[model samples]
Target: MSTLQQLLREIDAKQKRINKQRPLEQTKIKNLKDYFKVGLTYASNALEGSSLTEIETKVVLEDGIAVGGKSLKDHLDAIGHGRAFDWMWELAKGVAISEEDVKKMHVLCFQPSEGEQAGEYRHVNVVITGSQHNDRLPSHEEVPALMNAWAVGLPEKRKNRHPVQYAAQLHQEFIVIHPFADGNGRVARLLLNHALISQGYPPVIISPVFKHEYIQALEQSHTKPENFTAYIAEQALQAQRDYIRLLRIE
Candidate 1:
């Protein structure tokens, strides 16, 4: 078996153990969700260059307080991402991901701040700063068809691939498309977790501290897709461990 296959098996075993403890107490579930929302919001925004610290993100998200000296855009990013995180839970309960649901996540992540472009694909081209791939993203006119095809084909993809690999492919493909005018990374992360959560797996958090390595994996993906797939599987395994620890399950 390949490394990806081994990782998938490990994650599946852990998930089976987790499932036995399902229907976690309301209080425990609430606490875990609250903790992860703050962590995920902070990390996802930070990966995209938001200035809010984890503590500040928690304050801004939980208390609605503006941080001193922080850019208003940063605050909005936190608020918007937090809302999107909540919406992700609702989306998680769905049977499959849809193009409309993906657009709704972009809207939740970028609205008010980017009202005109929120939930909308870019009309102009953009480039990733440090990527070595250099391939042009699908143009504005092409996004609708590309996205529709992606959504329609997801069932077959899920059926053929392990959930971990499927989640990684979902993220990789979405980022490659770079559909929205902005907030694509945040939406992509949300979608990644959406795929995992929909399948009874806990969401993974990609720390900003690993931003360099994360970009490297994404860049290498163009040549060796397994590199990125393995990276995502590792992160999923870490999340499984974290979930087990959080529930104090042996």
Candidate 2:
């Protein structure tokens, strides 16, 4: 078997153990959810240049207080992304993922800063700064049609893939679409976790420390998508380990 296939098998084994503990997750995972809200909020924003430390993010999100000297947008991102993640947690329990779900997540994460443009698709072309092939992104005019087709075909695309691969594909594709004006990365990560969480897998938290490697994988995705997919599987493996640790699954 390929190494990723082997890793996936191990992930499946861990997931089975976690599934056995699912009844207690309603309580046990509740606390972990709050913990991950802070962790995910910190990592996702930091990857995008937010200045809030993890402690600062937790302070802004849970304590309802702003950090001493952070930018207003920084504080807002923590608060807003946390709320969107909350909604995504609820959404994961549902039967399907819809395009509206994607837009709503963008709105929740960006409305505090982006206003009416929150859920709206971009009207002008965007350039993915630092990417080698920015032209690979669809034009703003193409987003609506592309996203519609994507959401419509999601069920079929998800059918044969392993959950981790599906989640990674979801993340990669959403990032490529670059649907909304801002917050695409955050929303894309939300979509990734939504797929994973709904399937009894843990959310993959890409730490800021891995920022360079992560962006490189994403940028290279245009040519070698499996490289990115494998990168995501590695992240999923770590997330699965952390999740099992929190669940005390020995």
Candidate 3:
């Protein structure tokens, strides 16, 4: 069987357990596994294809590097804190971000440059997987169109589907488009949590701890079109586990 399909089956099985263990996630392995998945996904998105050894070193130092000096662990911690903060704040208000707000939020997140002050909002094209080779941007004009499709067709039924699924889809689509000069991953992650927070699920944290697996999933999606969905679904399942783990459940 294809890896993606295998992952799907695994996700469905895990989902059944997660639903049953809801509210009491900390007591069960099933719940812990799901939360672990969340930490992995956030780490994956933040530090895709990064090295763990380097991540640990920088993590110990607690220093934020502009572009390269930062390690995988640093990315994980940064994203985790950001997601948690947003999740808690949004939860208290009983509110969700609008599409307009998504764009503005992304702009704000991408504003800070290494040498510049915070809040610089990028207006240039972003290229992933090596900007030199994949320098093409997914037309800025098409961003809203694509986002609209994602917003409308996201997985998980309007009322029944886990909010994480929507957040995952939004993140994948945003990264695929490479919409900004910087902070695309961070923006995608923020949008991802917005969906989850709105739905009342704890924010998903993708840890740099699983950087390798995360990149492999994205690489599979980019190289094999038929497998992208499966890849994404699998990634989401893993992310669920990370979230549970962070909460110290199980």
Candidate 4:
């Protein structure tokens, strides 16, 4: 097996053990797990060159209905129109970005015309506004090149950083760059999970239940490295806990 495949198998084994311990309803848990897996799969596949529109069409709509017939970008926006609310909802339920949110995330990740929308805070040079750190705002010209550079740079960074920290760093950098006119927060979270899943870590859910803490942790990324790292680490440990609970393993 390829290294990536082997690592995933190990992650699955770990997740299974965690799942066994939780007292969640079997059917509900199964559905939730399926949705989660589908969401992650969609993300990885898209990054691997799957068509975004095709992936969105397959994952977002329920009961065989097309929401929009636009290009991939437009379709993403149509699907993700109300993603901020959805993101908070999923986080409340101990899930991170869902397949639905992933579609939205794809739409809002990085737009080419966000030079003004992405105002840069002079303090730390990371892209966030007061009390709400969204995505990085780049010059329209800068967005495409940055993403291309990131695509090349991310793998090495992922390997070197602790999985949780790596995930947070990606999240931070995404926001710092503010690549989109909108959807920066949601996309950043999605990128965070992609980092984890790629490395065989369970999806780290930023529970909206912990929104206060979540925002606080992100805010600290400006000057407090340890604080930021701790926040992501705490979330990672929770995913490990939840997985262990679900699988009922020692």
Candidate 5:
């Protein structure tokens, strides 16, 4: 088997172990959700160049205290992402993803600051700053049809692959579509977690520390899909380990 496949198996084994510990207590679930809300909001926003530290993110979301020197846009990103994270949980309880659900998450992530463009697709063409790949995103005119096909095909995609692989593919595909003008990266991560959580796995946080490797893997995805899938599998495994240790599951 390939390295990516092996990593996927390891992730699957860890997820099975986590599954055996569930129907986790309600309080435990609440605590986990609260913890991840801050961590993920921080990491996801930071990857997109938000200046909010994890502590600041927690303070902003929990204490509602604005940090001095941080841009208003940065504060709004954290708050908007927090709301998007909560909406993710609600979507996780559903049977399948929809285009409307995806747009709603984007709206939540951007509405706090960019209210008008909240969930709207960009009318202009864009470029990824450091990518080696030259693939062009679908034009704005193409987004609605492309996204509809993406949402409609998800069930079939999930059936033939491991959940982590499915999530990774979904994420990569969403980025390729670049459906929204901004917040595509944040929405993509939220969508990825939605798939994983729906499958009974803990949500993975791709730390800012891995930002270069993460972007590079994505840049090389067309030529080397395993690199991207393996990166995601590694993060998923780490998430599972963290969850297991935090809950003290025997």
Candidate 6:
């Protein structure tokens, strides 16, 4: 069997196991939610070159204490991302995604650093430093319509595809649009997680250690989109395994 097929099978098996335990204990839900708040904040920021460690991220979010030797922006990124992640959960209680949902997450994520432009699409074009294939982002003029279309089409997209594929499509398409002037990657990840969590899948954390591979997959998305889709499935399978461990599921 192909690797992607194997990963999807494993994911399906674990998801079935998890489904049998629906409505997990409140304590387990609370603990896992808190754990991922820090983990998602740290990893998402780290992928964008922030220097905060996972412990430091927790301290900033839980204790509001700033670590010395780290720039203020690092603390802001961590805290802001935590706020955004929380809002993602807020939206998870519902079934629809909207342009406002995407914009609001971006605003919360970047409000500390660039409040004025927080949720606003860029009026000026920009380039992603060091990127080659994935940098051919949509023109600034196209963002509004593209975003509207994406949000409008999601119900259909989710209806016909597997949850992992839907999330990957959601992630890849958002990155290609590059809607916001900054912090797009973090928000894209947030939306991806939102899509997964709403479908009862564990949130995928694209660790910084695999940032290169992740980016390469995204870059190749311009051509062989299946490669990127399969890469995302692999991440989802890993998350499923970890989630099962947390629940101590037999």
Winner of 4 and 5 under TM-score: 5
Poorest stretch of ten by lDDT in candidate 5:
130-139
lDDT for each residue of candidate 3 in 1-250, tens digit (9 for 90 to 100): 9675676566666556555545663456444333433443335344744443334433432343433665644454444433443443444245445455555554333333233422333445445653333533466566656666655555334355434444555666666776555556666666666665455444555566565655555555554544545545655676557554555445
Better of 3 and 5 by lDDT: 5
CA shift of 95, model 6, Å: 3.0
- Range of the 10 consecutive residues with the lowest summed lDDT in candidate 2: 21-30
lDDT tens digits, residue span 91-148, model 4 = 4354233334433445433333233333221223244456543443465567656655
Candidate 3 contains a number of clashing pairs equal to 32
> Per-model C-alpha lDDT, please?
0.90, 0.88, 0.51, 0.54, 0.89, 0.90
lDDT of 2 by residue, 19-118 (tens): 8876773666688789889999999999999999998998898889878878999988898899899999999986379999988998889876888899
Candidate 2: give the clashing pairs: none
- Per-residue CA lDDT of candidate 1, range 41-139, in tens? 999999999989999999999998999999999999999999999999877887598898888888988889997888887888777787766565777
Which of 3 and 6 is ahead in lDDT? 6
TM-score of each: 0.96, 0.97, 0.55, 0.53, 0.96, 0.96
TM-score of 5: 0.96
Compose the digit string of candidate 5's lDDT tens values, residues 127-176: 77766664566778898889989999999999988899999999999988
Give candidate 3's TM-score.
0.55
Cα miss at 76, model 2 (Å)?
0.5
lDDT of 6 by residue, 124-238 (tens): 7878776775457888998899899989999999999889999999999998888888888999999999999988898998899999999999888877788999999999999
- Clash count list over all predictions: 0, 0, 32, 21, 0, 0
The total number of steric clashes, by the backbone 3 Å criterion, in model 6 comes to: 0
- Winner by lDDT between candidate 6 and candidate 2: 6
